[model samples]
Target: MNRIKTDWTKPQKLSLVALLFIIGKTIKESWVLILYFIVRAFVKQNEDEDDTEKRSDKLIYFLLLTAAFLIFFQIQKFIQFFKTRIYIKDNELIEQTGIFTKKTKTIPIHKIQSVHLVQNYIHRFTDTCTMKVETAGTEKTELELSAIDYLKAQDLQEILQQKEAVSAANISDNNSTQLMGLSNFDLIKLAISENHIRTLSLIFAFAMSRLDDLRQFFGKKTDAIIDEQVNQINFTTSIVAGMIGLGIAITLAFSVIRVLLRYNDMQLTANQKGFKVKWGFLQTQQKMMLQNKVQLISWNSNFVRKLLGIKILRFFMVGENILKDDQYIKLPVLQEDVLKKLSAYYQPVWPSLNENPNYTHPSYAWRVTMIYILPVAFAASVALYFWEPWVMIIPILLFLYFLVTFKIRHMKFIFWYNQTSLQIQKGIWGDEHILLNFKKVQHVALETSPFLRRKNLATLVLHTAGDSIKIPYIPLTKAQAIADRCLYEIELDKS
Candidate 1:
């Protein structure tokens, strides 16, 4: 193989500079020494009028030092600009970095799971993109060929995909088709249907923690402002009101912005070889996934998304796929007809398909409440009895929660299996449908607690490279039969 040498595009130097500036501002260092020096300076001076002037000079000095650090960081980036390089060698993907003390990393070809082509805003202007490779190995990203020419990066992606395909099994001449994609109207639908609670919680948690840090920096009580505000209403009301305000704030701007940036012009396509998912606005990312490597396929949406009649589909793969979007192979806002197309394409792949799955047995509902709810409620009641009689109300609410969950969710769970796939359906806010390709099963086991044993029931645990699924309170004998069948199919596939 010929040696291929590449480095970051010229515009990446500016990117590096901006990154350093952000990092410098974010670094936390105690200002005790500076405070001490200011106090000492003021105390030593007999003139009261001059103290304020002296403090201003100290503040100016602090700003000057911060400016100096930023400049130094940018200079360091320039010095390391020429030292980073990535190349391909026989049976190995290699990266060489650092200047004086050279650091080299080598990842075997078979270990590489996915290669994503990424192009950020800077890269768009420079006609360059980053090729990020993820492997089944320990490192998060096996290799990142940062800021290479856009077209060259794509050719390299094809090369890596071909290598992986050869290792898994050679691909046939199967025609590729665009399976599904989001239009501009669909993008707006996704934005409106986005679940912003997760984002809101993260932002609120982060802001509260930062406020604590800032309070210490200025020597103020962190809860002092909160205590004064709490005089207006009860704690519960304050919390509920605050969450409502923040949820609206996040949903309007942050959630919409996140959805737009990640899923803009989203597309999903597949051929006989596997599937390819591409999306993004300022930075485009391409994730190539082989069907054999797919461990779990789940389709779910929140209550908001359900009202919009859309769902987000995600496929869990064996190894890391280094895309900016969290879900490695995510399909955006798919509805009915498209779901039918996906089911037809995938369900027909190995063998028999059973669209009507057997619902969970009637006994599972109450049994689940005993295993999941009763003990927790008992403990909460006991703990609250000593401290607050009013907290006894919590146990009553929890029992009601258990009753609802049992009736609505646990009893409605469905499970089915055939030669090719195992389908699991269970969710509350929105229907979650999981389709697991039987050949991808890594291991299978059955678990039984004393209670389950007494009841002649067992939980079937199905393991895959990415995650596990469990079906609780099935007959022990039946669970064993299903496990045996799954094992038999895996053997057949291997042969």
Candidate 2:
């Protein structure tokens, strides 16, 4: 450590755009203190002030304190940013951070799982992007270069991608292919056909959660405030209908806007290294994952998508990645033929869709009915006895829904496996098909309760690095056979 003379490149490596992030972080971290001071200053000034000079003096003091607090944090962050350095040295991506307590991190190029370059609305105008580097064992992005030149980011991504490809191989690791991209008309269609119901439900949930938050502030008065607001609205048929229409219109508008913003100019590409997905309008994102790291591939379609011959595809990569609940990449496939090609690329020897899958036991239907429908019906009936007849409507509707969907949900729960891969098909209105390479199976679990054992049925759970697929209410023999086959494939892969 004798004064290592190397090109550190801290000045060129840093971006002024990162000051925006630094300011945002400072505000986020110090918001409570900021708010507390402002509120205190206001309250003190308003407390029956006798002299204008005293009130002005108190206000000035408080303002000075707040400004000094914020300025101190801002200066600290600026200093840290100035001191931070990242560079490539000896086949490793190195980052040195911190001013007082210095730290250095070296990540081998081969260990990099993904490198994402993102440009939000602000970054786009600045010609800079945030590059996030993720590794296998880490739960979140391990290294994030707040802002870098777009060309420099691309070069870094290429170098990392080339390094990753050296150790990873896929079936179609040959030519660079533009698998799919959304056209203008297709983007409009996707936006229009977006699931407004799901969006509305999310909006509703968020509103309700906020209401609970309001309850914390308002105490018992929260309900009274809501009731007071509700009472002002005249409940005429026309008014009710207009409100419903307005809600639907709002939901549709929100969905369309969200879909457009998220998927505008979306493109999916395949290369010798892996797959890359680029999308978003206001905030552009480019994610690259290695082909060999993919453990499971799935595609699903709602009723609208099915009618339109469109499906949403998802790739599940290997690792203990728990951060992908909402962050998972979703690629839209417009053509069934394209989907087939993608599937073939992932699993060359997949089981045919026409093959008769091992369906769940017939008892699954009754068991579901007993577990779900009966309790709901009983609870509804009890509520009807205690309350008004209107209460029965919800339960009655739920019961009817269960009755209508019981057969499809239970009887259609089927799975088929070949020597190389396993495919599970399950859903009620929509169809979700998950394909897993047998060699990727990390473990097999066969679970049975006393009731299931008595009925000679067991649940087979195939655990992979990405997720778990549970095939329940199948014959014990079939369950065991599938587990055994998966273990055999796993051992074969090891060999």
List the global CA lDDT of all models.
Answer: 0.70, 0.80
What lDDT is reached at residue 339 by model 2? Answer: 81
Per-residue lDDT of 134-224 in model 2, one digit per residue for the tens?
Answer: 8776677888888877777776786677666774542324477888888888877787678887899998999999999999988999999
Per-model TM values vs. the true structure: 0.75, 0.83
Candidate 1 local lDDT, 142-187, one digit each (tens): 6666566666666556556666667677876457788888888888
Q: What is the C-alpha RMSD of each candidate to the true structure, in Å?
A: 6.8, 5.4
lDDT of 1: 0.70
Candidate 1 has which clashing residue pairs, if any?
Answer: none
Model 2 / residue 461 / CA error / Å = 0.6
